[model samples]
Target: MLRSIATFLCLRCQPVTALPLNLRSRATHSVAENQQTVEALYDLSVDIQKVRKLKGWVLLQSPAYTKEVAELLKNMGASGPIIAHILTSHPEAVLCNPEQIYTQKELWISVCPNQRELVGIIEKFPASFFTSSSHHDNQRNNISYFQSLNLNKRVITKLMASAPQSFSRPVEHNELMVHTLQQAYQELGGEEANMKIWLQKLLSQNPFVLLKPPEVLKENFLFLRDKGFSTPQLLHLLSRLKGFVTELNPDSMRRTLLYSQDTIGCSETELRDIILRCPALLYYPESTLAERFEGLLSAGISMCQITETPTVLELTTQIVNYRIQRLKARGYDIRTGSLEVLNGTKKDFEMSFGKLQLRRERPLFNPVAPLKADD
Candidate 1:
């Protein structure tokens, strides 16, 4: 494809007088510029065909100053293959003119301590680095606003790389969301000194929360409140959820709660207790809850046992089945016993399974031990 495009550009480079006037008017970009872009990309070892497949019109329709982009990256300490990978991964980046890219670099430099770190960020998140010029002021204002809040440069840099949309919007947009979070923290009796730490942790856990509307957060709070969660309980839930509370809608939460109650045969009070133990019960949709519930039942795991250890539902049905099979092979009856052994991460499960194996292999009656004591 690159060769074909280059050949076509060569054909178009013929003297304008050699072609009809109608054809001469059709050349949007000078053939010289198009040929140069392609040659630069090839020189840099970029997969030109991949870029064309990802964004076909990049070279023909847009003024892709790929050589300037490579030069800027090289100045930032990027190596040859890293630049090629960035271009291959996000071909649209070449559409950015040098001026816009320089502006973006200055904005990022305000948060990044040095060029090396900026290159690392670009290498990892190319799309985030090549933002549109239209977002320049908004990105600048948001960075300053976060700095005013005393957020470290590293955290601000992370926000840019991980969730650039949050920084691209107007500063007022983030202000409203931050204010809502602050108010919620204060209402929950959070200490003023700890509020910043809490806010930082929440944002680090899920930066995308900044992209959601403030009203969604408020509505989720109201829904949890109506479900009998006090303000302190709501704060606890938010902390346990790692600030992903905003991801849940009232309708989904309600559905999950109802399904949990029906499957576990638990009252609203009991359901609340289970949700406090495993917030996934409140976050997962009905379909997920249903699949887990059916798997537990099929494995002869009683609903009562499930209620006792609601965290077990966090594992998918397949994982549950596999773990159950392993335990059964070792003669551990999951149905007759508690579900506590299967309620944790992989390391936790291994440790618990090892203990069960030891228990199963221990001698029930050691008659020879009494003879030794007598001797």
Candidate 2:
């Protein structure tokens, strides 16, 4: 099919006296300004034909760039869907010189241990190859910086894959960012091992941290400390919560803290425990918390019970109520073992009690959902 289309395009491409005004810009120059070989080949008519033939990511350059990229891939022995994906996602990669592309491929292959693995990484992130070439010095310094923070190569590569934009910064800027993160680590009683631990937690919890402003991270780190999170507790919650990807506002953080302290009546130690055990509680809206609590109460769960098993608040009320009631109807005593019932998985609960077998109440319950309290 592609051959037929290319043939049709070649037949259609007659040297024209004038290109359309809208298509003229594309005919002028490519993203690769220094490469002069394709300068005379900037026949917009021919590129339009190749792009149409490709039927995927449209190449903005003339036929020369597309042909050269295909030739480069052929030389690398890359075939199959990988080639199509690389072109569609980062068509601009063709802008890199053949030598640059070859250099990047070799660099990745050196680390990847196999040809297929190298091609897989490039397929997902073709720009990875381009970034490695012109920025080897900066890349080395960045790797050392991550190592200084105790990130292993695997972890560093994971972080880079998630947020490649981090490599776009120069050595000086990345160094400043590293210093800011290290300072935050230091402020939190940074023992040798703890520095590595804290930095890795921060990175894994939020790969986007490498892309975030250092000041934002600094502010959030201090805010948690001001809220009385111990060093370890802060590290746990900081990564688990949205703060890793976003700047957590003081007001919002304070609101979660106050709710846990006032409404939940969590003691300082208990608050810390709750934050670490269930850091996601901070992101829940008050309405959701209230609704979950209300469901527990409506189903005869005491305030004391809810407080003791705060994690239960995370589960939907329907599930809790259904599981408890189902267990009760099956000759089990829920009042005596409510804690385990609420904490355990829904699958186990269903497995133990069988399929919520209430013929009369079937219509009222979701086929796959837990039964209503009354049902």
Candidate 3:
């Protein structure tokens, strides 16, 4: 078993199709009659030893169809190195029967525009394509259901590639979650025309939302409502979170809220206003928020400045320290300046820094002005 491990080192240079015609025909032989599954792996440059270690029981229980898997991938337009990499990365892919994989291909093709695109997805996410055959019915049903909803094909394809588990479960599971989201949107005053668009964007942003029990979403909504957030405000937060609201539970959210209010020395109304401006404060853990608060305070930033520019809290301690140092080096005192300059992604910070540098280096007086007489 260990000896076969040495063979995969050169697999990068060789393709399964490079095997001689006589050896290639053996792929059609029965698993029992053909004991060359290990040899097939070696020929394809797969790490047999690694596969044996990770999923040895698979080889012990039943023969792996490495050649068939390679053939299937080749027919789908995968290059030699891609095929080798996929098989190497996911050895259990060979355990799936050729017929099941064909059916999966057809199902994916129903949504994918062409084999080239499907091949690219398979290269990146081989497990999604080689999942258990038992989920075929559920996968088919869920694909049809999403299509019925008029969701764009690209979004459906993305969900299949990134979150196959969502499609493997019973169709009813997704239906319940979708219904909950729809009802919440309606209550939040979402219009009918925008319903499908909102749902599409939400699922595209976080397909795993479908895996959560519908009750979790309801409980979160109630918790936020109890915290004095109106329906429109809730919608704003949900949109801002990019549909990750399902990732939060009331306990964690309450803890984060308490930590924010206590550290900032803000009343409930003030904290609520801060949360509306920077929704992440409601989800970031106490440790993270505490570290950021300590960094800003130690830098001579006042609580009033922090409260006024809560978005700065989104930056990590290291980032805040680095940005403060950069601004200080440019003669800009963050202690006296608005903390708003620190509120944005990496690109935004670079733009702000560039503008600050220009202002500092710029000439205060006209260099070309006529010199006054010594008098």
Candidate 4:
């Protein structure tokens, strides 16, 4: 019985021995396969390097993987020459993260090492790669970004600070303080020309006259009055509103002059005289003001003042109606009953008028029809 038990134990141990041999064999085979794969990968990498060197291809290695470079390479057929040139030209391309070079709408070439070389590469590349207007636009944008990065902010600030202020402030005068007195001296009953002269005399002592000649302050006053601005309201609008309109609009200047005219009840001729008396208002026109005003108006600023008074409202309605009637006189359907007029904004009315005039002025294009063989 003891011999039988020993034999059974030996059989169990035999199975355990076979299990170890099978595991050892499997492990050895796996190691060999892995070694072979690694060797094959090494050989392929070597061949790739040889191709790069022979073709003068630069090796572009990013510190981290870059989808932009990968995509660029893929798109260019992963050409060895192009890759080598890009790598050699931009050695530091790999220093930045992929995100630094990639934008949603554009694929920018790296400009880390040498900008001139990068430009050259771009120029030499197949026209198909960057022939589209959008691609050229991307290149221009990238170049601008690079230039901005290189710009010295401190230098720019210093230059701006050194520049002189373009416009001088209004001069103060004791005589100009009496609005009633100024109104009594004006001719033409509140014309812009007369009021300008009065302001000049009143502000003669002031070194800088904010109100200029030929630009009546009373006309500006009247314009503002029509728009419903009180004396304090006009002041508030001039000082508090921060925008292109306030800074650059001649209409704003004109309105201010009108306001002064109405405030003093001076004539246009008097205003011109006032401007001459106060020479500061005669400063040269700033080129930027016109552009700035256009931008402000484009941003949907209805700066032309409107008054809530019944009489003024009636006048404004009449003016608008008259303008429409004038357009209709020229055969334009500008009446409120017309579909275009009903659907259009004030801006649209002007645009339509311009378009209509352009159409009439444009030469006709008439192509000869192809002749039929039977005919």
Tens digits of per-residue lDDT, candidate 2, 16-112, equal 2345656544342334222332332242122433333443223333333555665667566677456665765665665676766666565444335
Each candidate: what lDDT? 0.85, 0.60, 0.84, 0.36
Which candidate model has the greater lDDT, 2 or 3? 3
Which has the greatest TM-score? 3
Which candidate number would show the highest lDDT if scored against the true structure? Answer: 1
Per-residue lDDT, model 1, residue 277, is 87
Q: After superposition, how far is residue 225 of candidate 2 from its true place, in Å?
A: 3.4
Worst lDDT run of 10 residues, candidate 4, spans: 162-171
Preferred candidate (lDDT higher): 3 or 4:
3
Per-candidate TM equals 0.81, 0.59, 0.83, 0.18
**Could you tell me which residue pairs clash in candidate 2?**
none
Q: Write the per-residue lDDT of candidate 1 for residues 1-375, one digit (tens) a residue.
A: 999888876754544223353542223234533665666777888876665555545666456788899999999899999999998888778889999999999999999999999999998999899989999999999999999999978889999999999998999999999999999888877789988889988898899989989998889989999999888888888778866988999998988888778877878887888888898788888888889899999999988888888899999999889889999999889999889888789899999999999988999988777554554
Sort order, TM-score high to low: 3, 1, 2, 4
Lowest-scoring 10 consecutive residues by lDDT in candidate 1? 24-33
Q: RMSD of model 3, in Å?
A: 7.5
Model 1 C-alpha RMSD to native: 7.7
Expressed as tens digits, the lDDT of each residue in 1-375 for candidate 4 is 999778645533331112252332212112112333223223223232332234211122213232344344446355545544543343233233444444311433332233343344443432212222333443444334323434233221221122111011111221243243344233224445545444333333231222233234445445545644445544333222211111233465565456545533567666444433332222224233233333323433222321111111112233455555656666765322332431245576678678777776776754565556884
Of 2 and 4, the candidate ahead on TM-score is 2
Model 2 stretches astray by more than 4 angstroms:
1-57, 67-79, 89-92, 106-113, 126-137, 147-150, 230-232, 235-247, 259-270, 284-375
Overall local distance difference test of candidate 1: 0.85
Superposed by TM-score, candidate 4 places the C-alpha of residue 332 at a distance from the truth, in angstroms, of: 11
Candidate 4 lDDT for residue 115: 36
List residue ranges in candidate 4 displaced over 4 A. Answer: 1-98, 101-231, 234-242, 245-326, 330-375
